[model samples]
Target: MSALRIALADDQALVRAGLRALLERQGVEIAFEADDGQALLDRLQDTPVDVVLSDIRMPGVDGIAALERLRERGDRTPVLLLTTFDDSELLLRATEAGAQGFLLKDAAPEDLHEAIVRVAGGDTLLQPVSTEPVRARYRYHADDAPRALFSEREVSVLRLMAGGYSNKEIARAMFLAEGTVKNYVSVILEKLDTRDRTRAVLKAITLRVI
Candidate 1:
């Protein structure tokens, strides 16, 4: 396969420098870099990279707005969001904006590289740790009501997800195949009417479903 081409959007020059170095070492090409989300979007008009790694808190457009702009124009290029904190509000917004994944700025190089490849290969790469805070932040919305419609097994899968478990980990914990766990996650997301794992967990907490 051709080397993965990536575009980065972050305001901090140092962070971009570090990321460029790390991704370069992994045999990935830096299609371009932008100091803010608008510039990133502008560059994308011509660069046409395989994936986009963007900071959520950029000046002007910001990552969320940039993604929205892309989608508004029918740009389906996968986008991976980067954040400095595991903020639930941001997670929900990013999920709703159709992010392909979430990454903490301090994530290991290997994890970052893996996330890029996974997203490029048409898989969502959400880290449980990144969404745990969203769960806690929205836990206050829990209310006593009739349980949301989810199978017992599905609830078990969601509980593991809230605990920051990946599909592989959830499969091992539940003694099911990884593909089964992925299916369960997809069902949970659909049942909860959320776009991604982080939003699903947050919505589940808000409704006390899990």
Candidate 2:
């Protein structure tokens, strides 16, 4: 396959320059660059790329707003959000806004590379950020909603799923047969009333269940 094409967006020119160099070193193509979320949206008017790598916070038309507008326009182009901020609420907002993936800006090169590939190839990612704070905040509101209680094991599986692990990896880590993991995942989906893993995990987050 040809190198993966990516559109880069950030307010800091230095950050964009550094990312361009790092991505090029990894055999990734920089299809274009943009200074902010609005620029990213404008570029998308014509340029087509495999993935969109963007910072969460910017002056005008921040990443979340950009993503919302993209989806609002019925554009499902895969978007992977990057940020230096450690705010869990922001992560929730980004994921809910239809970002295919979310990662800290300090993510290792190999990890970043993997995220781009996964998002480009049609996968959602949460990157294992500790959502404890967000969960704590969301719990207050979650209490008012009907809850889907999960077993201890099920919760473990959901966390790993949020980390973007496959069933085989989850089974290996949790020391269970792969089939058993599948059963757990099925139960999770049924409990969350989701038809798929991505929606299950997203719902789990929205409900503060994981």
lDDT of each: 0.81, 0.84
For 1-210, candidate 1 gives per-residue lDDT tens digits of 889999999999998999999999999999999998889989999889899999888878899999999988989999998876745457766767888778888888998898888788777665433445665565543343323588889888888776557799899998999999999898888777667676677677666666
Candidate 1 ranges beyond 4 A from true positions: 128-156, 159-199, 205-210
Q: Tell me the lDDT of candidate 1.
A: 0.81
Best lDDT among the predictions, by candidate number: 2
In order of listing, the candidates' clash counts read 0, 0
RMSD of each: 4.1, 3.0
For 142-200, candidate 2 gives per-residue lDDT tens digits of 34342466888999999989887888889999999999999999988888777878767
Specify the highest-TM-score model's number.
2
Error of 2 at 92 (Å): 2.6
Where's the lowest-lDDT run of ten residues in candidate 1?
138-147
